[model samples]
Target: KERFISLTIKKKQQDVVRFLEANKIEFEEVDITMSEEQRQWMYKNIPPEKKPAQGNPLPPQIFNGNQYCGDYDSFFESKESNTVLSFLGLKPRLASNVVLQLLGQVTVVQ
Candidate 1:
């Protein structure tokens, strides 16, 4: 049972890392298993409502510069809804916006 849980955690962590890398988002992975201080920090930063009713919250917790984003399930939902950038507190790219400057005239696309 413990091994199964560990595997599940590992998979979730991998999924998050893969998505972040694919999107070219810079992130730092902290291994709570290696340091008690890091583990405590994670637990402390998580919002009270997000904490599990039982044991400590599992890994694969997402954050944007100390601001807690959410857990693995939240990340999956955001990905499904195409709101990952907003979920991570990132500004969306202006892909559809067009900017043109011609003859000292500026045009902005909204």
Candidate 2:
């Protein structure tokens, strides 16, 4: 059986995000402007680029939080994320995003 899959690159970030979200698809947004240090980190760890044609790079992750709560504290320190982190204030969203940006270094591609 053969299934056809289409991959279209969108010029605008918001439209790309909206399209995936509206369809319940998922993706990681890699910031083209990341510092060298960050790119090195992603390349060293993630294997997606090894076979760019086949693998969909898995977005960085927050890992399983049920086993690690202290891990949550260290991530929400940044000024931008801190705002959302602080507003949510010790709820699941706090932990969710803290891990999302910190370890994954990702912002849900939105």
Candidate 3:
């Protein structure tokens, strides 16, 4: 499913937009630059710990059906790990029974 992205007109935000476009990922963008209310909303909604120390919340704050998926670092990490599909819930979290056993949720007989 598509997701939402909060952004401002900045290099980092632009990079994220370009990344999503290149990947053909569907997303709705909210421009914090145009709306003070939106900016404040973003500031309030995003957890304080996630914000940078010196400024308001940065752009490209991604949301997966209302769940904050994190910023650029986390996003790219997911991409690099090929976990985007899993993050999007497009694929099963555990690809094999071995994962379940590793998590101590199942017993492996071998």
Q: Please give, for residues 35-104, the per-residue lDDT of candidate 3 as tens digits.
A: 6675565566667788889966545565444445566566568778978545443334322111000010
lDDT of all predictions: 0.63, 0.33, 0.47
Worst 10 residues of 1 by lDDT: 98-107
Candidate 2 displacement at residue 106 in angstroms: 4.2
lDDT (10s digit) by residue, model 2, range 1-110: 11221111222234324433564534454452355564454444433433246643323222222122122222223223644233322342323322222322433421
Model 2: worst 10 consecutive residues (lDDT sum) = 1-10
Name the lDDT value of residue 12 in candidate 1.
Answer: 75
TM-score of each: 0.80, 0.26, 0.58
Error of 2 at 90 (Å): 21
Q: Model 1, 1-110: lDDT tens per residue?
A: 98898788777766766776686655444446766776777788789999999988777676665677787888889999999777766678522222211111111222
Best by TM-score: 1
lDDT of 3 at 98: 12
Indicate the TM-score of model 1. Answer: 0.80
How many steric overlaps does candidate 2 have?
Answer: 0
